[model samples]
Target chain A: EPEVTQTPSHQVTQMGQEVILRCVPISNHLYFYWYRQILGQKVEFLVSFYNNEISEKSEIFDDQFSVERPDGSNFTLKIRSTKLEDSAMYFCASNAEGDRYEQYFGPGTRLTVT
Target chain B: GESVGLHLPTLSVQEGDNSIINCAYSNSASDYFIWYKQESGKGPQFIIDIRSNMDKRQGQRVTVLLNKTVKHLSLQIAATQPGDSAVYFCAEIGAGGYNKLIFGAGTRLAVHP
Candidate 1:
């Protein structure tokens, strides 16, 4: 079974530094999404992407966040400046066109900012 | 604002027993619901999903029940095993454009020998 893959399983960065989390979604998937789960909190949606444009984003996804599909296979999320509260598990997900509601998620990248 | 919540924070079950996790969603416009299992340090894995038009759906040893009237969803696992232990979450997707998913807090399932 093909699954979404994320790079840098764990990332540590200094506060005020920039961090880019990378993901390679399933090859055939058309829709991609970014989500974050704070320790001991529910997973929260960050943004959704389709056709190289952001479809929707949450208040949590503010000015500091940006997503890019720089290549056919790579989707990346960049945080302009990291903060202590920015530490969390960031997940990437994708879905085939036929089943838009069912998304396959990657193992996730644990971002730790200090 | 829409919210999804689980009935309990934790559930403990004997190895051979069946386990059921319940969720309540407050989005009437939600047309799709999914159940996901998240082990420690991992992302949510899709288990099963049901549409608003369907009352029930089954896959492998798992079954999902949906009640549109009460806005309730439940995931039942048969012959629960230690490997089945994890934090289970229920997510809902509205009929809106983005197809963003809102997840519940989640229920921690513990299977004991």
Candidate 2:
């Protein structure tokens, strides 16, 4: 089965530095999303992307966060300045249809800020 | 202002036994619910889903029951195996195409062989 894939399975970055998490959703998927889970916490939605633009975002997705399609296969999340609290597991998900409620999730990228 | 929740945090059962994971939701308007299984170091995988219009839906060895009046959902796994050990979460989405989801803390199931 085709699955969503993410790059840099694990990353470590300085507190003030920038980090980019990459994901390649299923080729035919139209709806893309970014979510995060803090350790021992619930998965929180960050933003949703469609038509190469942001469709919706949460309060957690503040000024420091940005997402880009960049290319056909790459959906990326960029954090301008990482903070200690920015460390978490970042996930990317996609849905194949406009009305389909099912979303496929990637393995996730573990971001560690120190 | 709604939430999806699980009744138990952990459950253990022997191989060949049946397991039932329970969940509760506060959103009366939610029309769709799903169960996701997540093993350690992996992402959440879809198990099965149910709609408010229906009371039950079954897939493979798993069955999902939804009680709309009480706002409850349950996943019943028959003849559970070791592979069934994982964290099970109940998620609910509101009425819409792009409706966001509310997830429960999750129940960790351990199927011992």
DockQ (Cα-based) for each candidate: 0.87, 0.68
The residue-by-residue lDDT of candidate 2 on A1-114, one tens digit each, is 999999899999999999999999999998999989898887788888888889888889999999999889899999999999999999999988754678899999999999
Number of the top-ranking candidate, with DockQ as the measure = 1
Model 2 clash count equals 0
First chain TM-score, candidate 1: 0.99
Interface RMSD computed for candidate 1 is what? 0.7
TM-score, per-candidate, Cα-based? 0.98, 0.96
TM-score between model 1 and native: 0.98
Off by over 4 Å in 1: none
Which tens-of-lDDT digit does each residue in B3-60 have in candidate 1? 9999999999999999999999998878889999999888899999998999999999
Model 2: CA > 4 A from native:
none
